[model samples]
Target: MKKFIMKKKKILIVLMLALLLASGCSTNDTKNNINKLEAENRLLQEKIKNLEKELNSYKKESKEKITIYYIKSTQNDFVLIPEVITIEPEPNMLKAALEKLIQDKRNPFPKDTRVIDVTVKDFIAYPNFSREITKLSVGSRGEELAVASIANTLIKFPGVEKVQILVEGQTVETLAGHVDTSKPLGRNETLISIE
Candidate 1:
């Protein structure tokens, strides 16, 4: 009977030691998990704060008015006048400007002219348009005037030094089979009518 009691005690001690080790490991894992979660939460909070700052700055800029340059074609198709226009405010300023420019009935661009996409990188503007641009009745003088007009108008925007016109998201040799548009073009102020 004494031996039986000693064996039972040994079993109890071993069970207690196993339980202690298991609980200790569990507690350490829980602590590590909690610490990792806390770090992730801090990173997310910082990102939210930065996004809030950017939103506030954009809101302020949205209230500021912007001026856009446009081309006003004269009765002579070869001549164009540079005109300045202003709008209250818009998120996409360049897009808005282009929309207004196409609205002018005097320009060679059709009333249905559409801008597919526009992006500015490294001070260059890539304006993708529909194939209607190539459908126009084009002459050397008319092409020169129209191309220069659009290029000059786009360059008026801050940070835009040159423009590369695209059609259906692909580069073209020329918009009207006249000007060499195989590459991006800069503003040509000389094309604007002095008047």
Candidate 2:
């Protein structure tokens, strides 16, 4: 489409130049017209270059993808499943990733699981969850899977190296009494199928 428009513009410019040549105007007037057309052509070329550059930049940004972790059962037990998704760059990217992680209802976590708050400092993410997350009855395996899911998801963010889970602003020992939650948790890639 751009090519077609450019062709039409070129033909119009040619017609304009032909008109100027045939008008039999004074030499000074013809020179001014040529200069004016040249300036307009330059502007058009610059505009097209800027548009192409913006288009390439948009394509680059759209191709970017982010990984989110969800709990999925393999053979023996539940594990963290990595899912690739695209999100616009934002200040609250950690919170957005956690929100995506909560969308999978089939995971070990309860359906009402949600991220209440998130903060990052020194490469550590403090992600607080709703009380609904800790009330699941899926046993120790479920609890561990839940923790791994949250930890793995947070670490996918740029600056988050570990995650500290909180429930209503207090760090509990465990979400379901399976894994230790008194400290910040790092990514547990070994728990996943890795395929």
Candidate with maximal lDDT:
2
Q: Candidate 2, which ten residues in sequence have the lowest lDDT sum?
A: 59-68
Q: What tens-digit string does per-residue lDDT give for candidate 2 at 47-128?
A: 9999999998997777546787777767776777788888766567787778777776756667787888899989989998
Number of colliding residue pairs in each model: 0, 0
Name the candidate that leads on TM-score: 2
Off by over 4 Å in 1: 1-77
The digit string of per-residue lDDT tens for model 1 on 1-195 reads 999999999999999999999999999999999999999999999999999999988877666344333445567545567666656476677777776666767667776778776789999998888888777575887778667767777788899999998888998999788899879999886666756
Give me the displacement of residue 118 in model 1, in angstroms. 1.6
For model 1 the TM-score comes to 0.61
